[model samples]
Target: MCGTCGCGEEGTVSIRKPGEDTGEHTHSHSHAHDHQGHAHEHSHQHKHAHSHAHEGHQQHHESSHGHEHGGNGHHHRHEREIQLEIDVMQKNNLLAERNRGYFEAKQILALNLVSSPGSGKTSLLEKTIKDFKSQKKIYIIEGDQQTMNDADRIEKAGAPVVQVNTGSGCHLDADMINKAVKILEVEDHSLLFIENVGNLVCPSLFNLGEQKRVVIVSTTEGEDKPIKYPNMFQSSDVCIINKTDLLPYLDFDLEKMKEYALRVNHQLEFIEISVKNGEGLNKWYAWLKNLSL
Candidate 1:
């Protein structure tokens, strides 16, 4: 299991291009197997002894002391769990820095787009690709737990794309991008959009070495999403408010959403767009263009 999130078991990730054989790209974990075929995980089992003593002398205590001793063990276990999470994050961050250096050397403008499921992320990408393909060379890395649906759509949209099916993984890690780059071979001085798994919580914790992180929120969802998922808002550089065309028929408050997002991330830049009718898309395109400058 992932030490950071306790997510998918190892060996559950797969990366492939559209129309490729499904069985060719599974990522496997290296684990030893016993005679019974049980996977043996190498882990350190530490037994911690918590002794409550006064001045190095053993204290003879009753039920109250027993409760205190048990509580100490629980707190100690919690600390170990937190430390394990930190170690996992640090390792991922190191890999992310390596990916960042690669992108810098190649002059690749990589953007990681994250949002909840059905938040119009894919629609925004389709619109962006169709409208801006003439001006900028674009490529895509689509992330999902299963299916090549988004990658197929992006390929049809006129860009070379790769699909990363992370089986039970909740977020795309730096190693996945490093592998996808080899297959996609994104061109220099081009934009690479990584459509992360449709998740708000776990994706916020994993950095795929993108130059910018964009969070999409739709009018159909709660306006208080920023406060509910503050880490996502704080980590993202841009907030794209999609489905504005449905605002008149819905009870969504646009200004309040912006206010809440700004409260979480004062540095966040907002662009309101509706992919269905092409409203405010020019502003989104303009933002993309300015990134190259």
Candidate 2:
């Protein structure tokens, strides 16, 4: 399982290129059903550490105080797990720094856009690409658990794209981005948008070496989302309050949401936009354009 979220890792985080057949792809998990309000923990991502059979095996040892090392009891295992978690995160941070250096060298403006499911991230991306595709070289890395649907939409929007299906994993860590970047072969002086998996909680703990982390929150979601999921709001460099066209029909308080977000992140840049009607999108586009300069 992915050490980041404790979800089963049997799912494939495969990179799918446009025009390639997906018939050969097979996975053990699909759909976003894994993230059901569980507090995401350190995913001890070592290959041999955990297995599905471990569940059945663990049930057999109620006490679990094996005498393999002279009855060290559960305390030894707990300490070891904590150490391993630290080690894994250290390794991920190191790799993320490497990715940052690579992007700096290539002059690539990489933005990591994160949000909850159905936050209109893809819609915003489509509009962003359409707005600047002719003047800029844009590449996309789409992350999901099971399908290439988002990547297909992005490809139709006139940009080179790669989809990384994270199977059951709730979030995409830096190692995933490191591999995805190699597959994208992103050019110099271009923009790389990594549309991370639709998760608000687990994705916050891991940094994918992005130049900016843009978190999108729709008007349909509660204004208290910032307080409920403060980590993402605090970590994000920019927060886009999307779907402003629905604001008239919804009861969401725009100013209240901004207040909550600012409470968590005083310096978070905000851009309110509606991809449906082109309202406030110019500012969003300009924000992106200035980042490259």
Candidate 3:
């Protein structure tokens, strides 16, 4: 009897010796035993042993395919990715070197002014231009995120000015200044002031071929500015504390601010000025005149 087909269920097969009785019970019992043996052999070969090996091999192949996709999938195209990431900063640095050489060739003293938005940098420049109009030929490169307002003010003060709108860049890089320099008539032995975009952080990292870096800090700003933004203070050659006339109206601690600044940069020169009142600008003019000599 076949195990899967259940052929013994229809009828019993009789098998007897020559003189023995042929019993249906004996025949049915023997057929059931043969069916059970067949089932065991079939299960061992196909369902239990073979299925487990096939499943394990399929899992191993899938794991190997996943690993290949995850590791070194871009090995053949790594060179193109590296070329795309070639340093943008290196190009800016080279332009800065060229601008420095150009400044040297023209014999012009350039100053890059850096500060926050309302540090009165433009007001200070206007006052400086007015004070030194007869002493020096002043030229300005105005950098801002938007309009030509600062450049207009400088021009009304009777100085040659060029405005650079950086669109959305946070700071003016050396390449921007190099292009702006060509627009302005920078005579030999003139004072070229580059009013950098009103940002304290990013502007300090860029050198715009300036002989001096001046940072403008106002009395309205807290006295702890020197310590909070130490990089700007440390990079500056001159620190101008603008709006000193407001000292009586505000609770500003001048001595502490100066102390912190000197601690950060021992060689930093400082000037106190109020462009509105025309006070303390003489000292600033004197410093610029000395630079030219």
lDDT value, residue 225 of candidate 3: 92
Give stretches of model 3 more than 4 Å off.
1-88
Clashing pairs in 3: none
Candidate 2, residues 21-115, lDDT tens digits: the string is 76234343334545632312323332235443244444444554554543323222222233343554676688889999999999999999999
Q: Output the better candidate (2/3) by TM-score.
A: 2
Candidate 3 lands at a TM-score of 0.70
Candidate achieving higher lDDT, 1 or 3: 1
> CA shift at 75, candidate 1, in angstroms?
31
> Among all windows of ten consecutive residues in candidate 3, which has the lowest summed lDDT?
73-82
Give per-residue CA lDDT, model 1, range 134-171, as digits (tens): 98899999999899999899888888989998877788
Winner by TM-score between candidate 3 and candidate 1: 1
- Give, for candidate 2, the lowest lDDT window spanning 10 residues: 39-48
Poorest 10 consecutive residues of model 1 by lDDT? 39-48
lDDT of candidate 2?
0.82
